[model samples]
Target: MGSRNSDRIPIQMRRRKCETVADMAAQGWDVLSKCQACGLVMRVNLKMIAKVSGPATSLWNRKQRCRRVGCTGFIEFQGRAPDMHWHETLAAPSDGEM
Candidate 1:
């Protein structure tokens, strides 16, 4: 009798308040976004931050797809600035490390 399955969908618990990317960086909080359709999690990075800083873009309005194969689900980010200005650091490989 149901036209769509409810159990297959994911429940997204996004941040209730929106904050700027700079604020998040200042507070030591990484932009955490979860897929609303499949519960997949994606962290905001420098690239993502730069991508949304164009003339018309928003971090919260960005949509991404679930990484799992065969999962016909899409995720959107909300409750914050659509861009950021931070980058994560990684340890450099020593001597002959590729």
Candidate 2:
């Protein structure tokens, strides 16, 4: 007699392993810190490190909102450094402005 589904332990174990790897990859970048002055949020790749600091800070706290009154440019934490052109968008506030 041939092995049936009940005897397919190796197949089931392989499937479980694949699922675990997929789950790990899915847990990508999570917000880590925020700059209160500019409302810029910093995100760190969670899966990269085994442990993370700043347990007191909430993940959502790093979410950046639109700086402009009506502009929809939401702040985001990028893994790599941004290009020089991107910095041009940040307008310097005048002496009177906060």
Pick the lDDT winner. 1
Model 1: how far residue 58 lies from native, Å? 1.6
- Candidate 1: which pairs clash? 58-82, 59-82
Instruction: Put down candidate 2 lDDT per residue, 1-98, tens digits, no spaces.
Output: 67345332332232232222223234332223334455655444544433443222222213456465655555543221111112111222233232
Best by TM-score: 1
Look at candidate 2 and tell me the lDDT of residue 82.
19
Model 2, poorest ten-residue lDDT window?
80-89
Model 1 TM-score, 2 decimals: 0.38
Task: Give each model a TM-score.
Answer: 0.38, 0.20
Whole-model lDDT, model 1: 0.44
Tens-digit lDDT string for candidate 1 (1-98): 65455333221211222223544444444555566677776676634564567322334345567677877787655333223233222112233222
Error of 1 at 63 (Å): 2.7
